[model samples]
Each structure stands twice: as C-alpha cells, then as structure tokens.
Target: MSLSPRFYDLLMKGSFFFVGGLAGSMYATHHHHDNLKILKQDLNILHPPTREFGHAEEKVEVSKDLAVRDVLKYGNPGPIADALARKAYVAAYDRRLRHSAWTAEHLTAASIARPPTTDTSGPVDRGKSKFIEDEDLPIPFRARLADYFKSGYDRGHMVPAADAKSSQEAMDETFLLSNIAPQVGDGFNRHYWAYLEDWCRRLTGNFADVYVFTVPLYLPRLGTDWEMACVIGSPPNVSVVLASKPSSPLTPDVLELSAGAFVLPNAAIPDTAPMESFVMPIEAVEHAAGIQLFSKAVKAAAKPICATTKCELIIRKFDDAQKKPNLRRAVSGLV
Candidate 1:
C-alpha cells in the first residue's frame, strides 16, 4: 500500500539529518545521587506557573525532590543501549528490545571486496557463519535463539552479511543476535529487503564513500489511537538510509553528500511495488525512532540521493534461486 499524503508531504519538505560518519561513541557509568539532583532540576522546566483570569499570576515551584529521589534511589532505570563495534559495522543494542536500535556501516569498494586467495583465511563464506548470541551482552538481555523458534519470522540481519565479505570474522559478526531483528522471511527479508540492501552496496561504485544506517522503527498507524502490541519478537518496521559522497570533487576541497531514506513494513512486499513508494522523510524516521540521524547543517546541504542516482531496486528472484529452509530445523542446531 502507498503511504498517506501526510507522509508524502514530509518527504517533499526535503530536510533530514544524516549522521556524518558513524554513530557517536557512548559510555556507560554508574548513576550517583548528585546526578539525580541535576536530573530533577532539568526536569522541573516542564512545570509551568499557574495563573487566574485578570488576577496577578502566582508563581508556584513544583517540588520534584521526593519524586526524583524515590525514583532514582536504586539507580536510574535507563533506556540503556550497548554500543558495539564489530569488524564490519557499529551498532547500538537496545537491552529492552533485545535487538539493535540501529547499525551503521561504511562501505567502499575495498571494504566489500572479496579477500585475496593468498590470505591465510579463506574468503568470507555465508554458509560457514552461524547465528550466535552476543556473549558481550548480559544473558538476560540477549535475543535468544529460542525467540525465533517457531516464531514465524526470520532472524534478519541489520547489517547484511554480504556487506562484510572482506573477512570471515566480519561476516560472522553480522550473525550476532544483537544485530538481528524479526523479519518476515519470504517476500520481505529474503526478497525486497535483500534487493534494497544490494542497492546500498551498489552505491559504492558511484560514490567514494557509502554509509548506511539500519533502524528498527515502530510507527503509529494514521488516523487512529496508537495501540501497542506485545509480540513474541522485537521491532516491527525497518528504516534504512544511504548516504554517499561523490567520487569526483565538486570543488578542489569539497565533495557533496547525498542521501535517501526508506521505511518498509515487516511484511511481504510485491516485486511490482516501486522502491520509490517507500521513500520517507529523514525527520519522520528520526522522530519515530527517537534518534537524531543527522545534524541540521548536513541535512541542509545534502542533495536528494535519488536526484543524483537512480533509486530503483533490481529484481532478483532470490526465492526462486534457492529453496526455503525450515526455520525450526536450521536454528534447532544452534540451540
């Protein structure tokens, strides 16, 4: 189905953030009582002074001390994300969701190239890679192999395995549960999503540097109250943004950046569906996912990626080319 007019309008506005390089490094620390007091002060700005008609306004200070102190007595219950760096990509894993909040990868001709035969290790092989839990994460917060067992979803890679063809270790890193989410197997992940991924990789040919961010989003349905659903799995929607710097310089010292954002449902999509139909505003994606993807200056200066290059997806009959494997049998061994 096509997106609503409102979504189309947002796309036309033509401004969105493209986090210049990779996501910033994040550090975790123990929360102290002093920090809680500072947080209370910052939160108090939400309180507005009360006033009556035609009377002097009364200034009231809301005492947030008790609430803040009680809430943080144990420590800040955070919406915490674990920053992870792999051989091929960088990602932030959401502990609550048990999947990556987003993954960033820098793709260049050399980065995605197959390894030389002279290397000690053989070229990266997808057949040899296995889906494994990220041991770096706490056991309680990791996405378990059992979660997708008979769950009717694919253990989809946020950073495509093909993007990490440079090394066997890099390809294996993409199989980590932290970099995966529940995706519809047939028409979506195996078909259309794969096509979109190939398109991003192809950008390396035209641009000197290609950066892609994969984000899992939960957008509300239009014209209805936003209802939350609890599923056996994690995030339901995916948004991917591709930003590229042109190979040739526009000026001796400058190279222009161009980017495009696309959001797709975690369901089967028809091959006939135009890739352009999924075009989304970068602002819309940032607001929906609660993450700033780019700075104002970068957004203002970036040219619409589709304008600089063709945004069409090449149809590859992946399903026809390969037989569907039984999800249960495949993952049962991993357990």
Candidate 2:
C-alpha cells in the first residue's frame, strides 16, 4: 500500500505525543502517591484514628490510686462576698437570715468510717466544743447560743455532726453557730432530717464519693393569724411578713424565704422512696435559692449523674418511710 507523506508525518507525531503523555502520567502518578503517603504520615501524627467518629483516644496518667478524695469537687454558692466557714465541711452564712445559705461536703465510706465522737443524744461537753456565737460574723448580726435557748426550735445543724465523725475537731466544727439553723425539734430535725442524714451516710456503700449540698429553703408559710409569710429566721419576725389577702390580685410571683428542706441523694438511695422523690435538678435549687449552686468548674469536674429525674431504683420501703407515731409535723407552720 502507498502511504501519503502527510499521513505518515501525522502518524509519527501522534506516536511521539502518546509516548510522552504516557511517561508524564506515570511520573505524575508516582509523585502524587509519594505526596499522599507523606500527607497521611503528617495526619497520623496530629490525629490517629479513634475507635469511632467524633470520638477521641487519650491516655491519662495518675500518680496515686484513686480515692474518694481524688474524685469530689468543692464549691460555695452565695453572696460571693459573704465569709465562708471553711471547716471539715464548708458553709456560707447569711447574717441577714442568721443561717447558712448552703453547706457542702464530700463524703465517702472511708471519710465517715469512724464512730461519732460524742453521744448522739447526750449533752455536748462544752470542754470539747460549745455552740458559741460565730465570732466570724459582724457584731450586730451575729447569731448566738442564747438566741436559740427556749426559742422552741432546735439549734439544727446544716452539716450533720455524724458527717464529721472522722475527727473530734471536725465534729466540733460542725457545732459552730454558723452551721446551725433553727430546725423544728422532734419531727423534722431529730427524725426525718436525721433519717435523711443517715441515708446520706449510707450512700457510701454504693459510690466512692458523694458530693452533697445541704441547703436551707425558706419558702412561703401560713401564719398563726392565717396570714401568708415568707419566714426567714428561727424567731418569726412578724414585721417582715407581707400582708396580702388570698383574694387580692397577684402582681408578680411572690416567694417567701419561708420554709422547705431538700435532700439530694446523688447515687441510688437504699431501695426505699422513689429515687425521683429525692433526686432534684440543680436548676430547681438555683431557682429556689436565687443563687447558682454549681460553678463552671464544679460542673466540669464531676457532673451530677442523677441531675435528671429519670429513676428506676426503688431502694427503701414506702411504709417504713412513713412518719413515726410520735413524730409531730415538725415543718408545720414553717413550710
């Protein structure tokens, strides 16, 4: 066959172009793969593959075996300006209320292991520690032991004495008037309140550490005169009671720092009362207290596992939680 000169020339050029293109593609592919491998190595150093997406793998080292002390975090929520009674437990005393706004403690099985230093019912030996005025307070507003005498209210403790069982100094610190409140005598303080305290100590059985916030809530109350009052202190100051008839039109939500007691058990309470009954959301407390209880650091350190109301554990017997025959309505006329 006779080939045209133009056709031959075009064929030779096309062949040369194909060979050059092929060589260029092979070199580019090799270089691209090398660059990709280097990029992958850099990525691996920055972030290795985790077990799952949106998850991170980290290695944390600890110097000592984990203790309850190592787990719990501390915070005080109050007039950040107020003096703090930093003892075995901590309290923020409100001189205006003449009571602690809140008392907090970190409890553990080991922390509460020791027997109570003093008899639970017996008289406190002043030699050990006495309920004296909190010199910590300013003079005019200080609460004194004399104020509680014959006041028809027990010098109630926000932080129970039993929680301070580990040491005499700790137990004694609990007796300070700063930590005391005018709690109702036999029914609430000595009975139901005591029961709650016992339940708190019992929690050590389940959790390594329990962070507790013992708060005093002065909610609205019905007075002897059938008047509504927000009781603030032990001795009801009649002047502070706002005279508003029930029939009157409401303007704003009226809340009295009158009376309510809350016990927030962190872990599963003994299969008794519905755990939901005891577990309270921090927001509820913050609303009632008009103060933020948990700070950012506290929230970050160990978020409360039972902050939500979802509960499945029934730990205590219902009937057993009933008030005793002799138990008077201690919170009566108060809440």
Looking at model 2, residue 170 earns an lDDT score of: 77
Residue 64 lDDT in candidate 1: 73
Give per-residue CA lDDT, model 2, range 1-335, as digits (tens): 12134322322221100000000133333432342233233223223454222312233565455563365435323343355655468777777777776677777788877654455544333357668777777777778878887776678777778887666677888888888876544323554445556655665665545656666643343345967545334321000000111222373343211111233211111212322233333433444454555544444444344331122221222345575343222111111
Work out the TM-score per prediction.
Answer: 0.71, 0.49
Per-residue CA lDDT of model 1 for 128-193, tens digit only, reads 999999999988899899989997678988898999988889999999999888775665677667
Which residue runs does candidate 1 get wrong by more than 4 Å?
1-73, 221-236, 246-252, 318-335
lDDT of 1 at 76: 74
Model 2 lDDT, full chain set: 0.45
Q: How far is 199's C-alpha from truth in model 1 (Å)?
A: 0.3
Per-residue error (Å), model 1, residue 224: 5.8
